[model samples]
Target: MRMMVAGLAMMPADAQDIEPDGPDIVVTAGKPLRVDAKLLRAAQRRFAEDRPAHAPRATLRFELWRGYSRISATDVGLALTDGAGGQLPVTIDGDGRVVFATLPAGRWFLTAPAQSQGMHLRPIVLSSGTSVEDRRLGDLRAQCRVMVAMAKADASLLAMPLIGMFDAIGGCASKRFGFYHPVEHPLASATATGAGVMRTLRLSVTSTSYEAPLSDRNLPNDARVRLAYR
Candidate 1:
């Protein structure tokens, strides 16, 4: 089967890449502050022979939302790695989607977190003779859950809209689409004490795209994006 390989986004143009509107923050007094580092990407695999049976491939498409309308991202790219440390270079388009080629069939971990955010993993299983059509909403759902799990695992920072976009694409909107909508509440609040230094970072995630207090509908409003920095 014929598959199209796309590009990925590496960096944001300016500080605007970091959006401040997300889950509520709770800066505690005594919690350990851990620092994170950017992912070190390796070179893409170079194969001498490309056989049809062993040639693996896949495509990733993201419907980026800047409020009600859908938009695309720039310079979005990803690095694929097996558990063994082998890496493959993949590119994404303005829409935050990518079609990759020359992959060997096996279990591989696909991570394409925004440059503004840390690297996130999306495990993909590529079998021989598979094409984009084989990709389904189920695949997107699984990847979304993994992203949320990653954010929860990382106590340093949280990812926004990814969980929500996961909601819309994962078919949380309609059961007629054969997608199961899990019930979860998202809230952002802070607990305070007499000392007033902040204590726990309790943030509930949601799938909402636009900013709250939705007045003055801005055209180029803050789009839903992730952050990866120390």
Candidate 2:
């Protein structure tokens, strides 16, 4: 059971909470309102977090894909948890989504407690496809829902994409392949504002290789090449 270990990751840069596309306001209600730094920080943290105690809870739905296509994941388990490592009840719904069907609106992550060499915990990693491909078509990085999959009973869990290439030029100029790092990373993450509302986070796990440069040269688009030689 050979598995490709991942390399150092460029944790998909997350989207900072920002005022929706508008500009114009000056210094507020005419007097510098001195806010307690701690309180201010707590307020800002709300955007990325909520409490199950926040009442009525909200819904978080996930649509994980195979790179940039409509094809979806199948036959896998979703391991969800909170910042403290308590398991959050997550499931795959009828719509083929990994969901916290009803959870307190707050920051949620997909990871579990792993005592790997004094390592506190790492996100549960899942690999889709014969070799997951829908995840690497672009530089689009998202982290509202931390990602890692449990696809095989005995599989090597990697922390990041094992290979990366310039999606446009379709070449190995990036030199992202054939590297390994010990760090494990999440697949996706989100702060569900589950105030009886549903938030959807979409992700794609991609693994790609250009066959033209290989010995066969005529492999199918879905060819499963050895990651060691990609």
Candidate 3:
């Protein structure tokens, strides 16, 4: 996938200058994208030419939607525990996410500091499926105008507030952390969304992962989305 028409504003680096420093693969189902920023623009052009035409759908869009922001967490830490009264090993990613490499099929508890100190809920009985996959952009507020977006069919663009906070003029899903990441780290969301590349972290999760459905809602309209998965 390539970057879409979100107004790419980087000083063009000739294609010959790109050195193969990492993997540059198509972001397909169950596959992850890992590419270097230096090679991004050239990749976008390459993919856009070969990309297929969509059936006049809404523009592809990805944004750091203010509607999905979480509440301001106070040193909000998370932990995992096994049912055997034992603690499980866990780690925090750069994005402040609790990651467990492999979870066995057994009852486990995720501990966190919520509203009340004595607050404790039953171990969640879940069916292993998440509809909306949102990975919060960490510390990107200063870079708001620099957001970049790409389309699955090789469309890519940039979101610059210099264009009037044009792409990013709203809020976060939660008000916790201020979202920056418009296009600095290449925050990308195009007028359309397909398997386009954005930042480094290719999505192995979320809406696009399921492929475009018969009735699609991921339209594009220049929303200022923070860079995620980078």
Using lDDT, give the best candidate's number.
1
> After best superposition, candidate 2 residue 104: deviation in angstroms?
3.3
Against the true structure, candidate 2 reaches a TM-score of 0.22
User: Any runs in candidate 3 off by more than 4 Å, and if so which?
Assistant: 1-68, 71-74, 115-190, 193-230
Better of 2 and 3 by TM-score: 3
**Model 3 over residues 1-230: C-alpha lDDT tens digits?**
11212222121122222211111122233322222222223323322332223211211112111112322222445455555776654455443333334444455544443332322111000112211222212111111111222212222334233232323333222222122112212223312233342332221122121111111223222212232323
Regarding TM-score, does 1 or 2 come out ahead?
1
Off by over 4 Å in 1: 1-60, 63-77, 101-103, 112-230
Range of the 10 consecutive residues with the lowest summed lDDT in candidate 3: 122-131
lDDT of 3: 0.25
What is the clash tally of candidate 2? 29
True-structure RMSD, every candidate: 19.0, 20.2, 19.6
**CA-lDDT, candidates in order:** 0.27, 0.25, 0.25
TM-score of each: 0.25, 0.22, 0.25
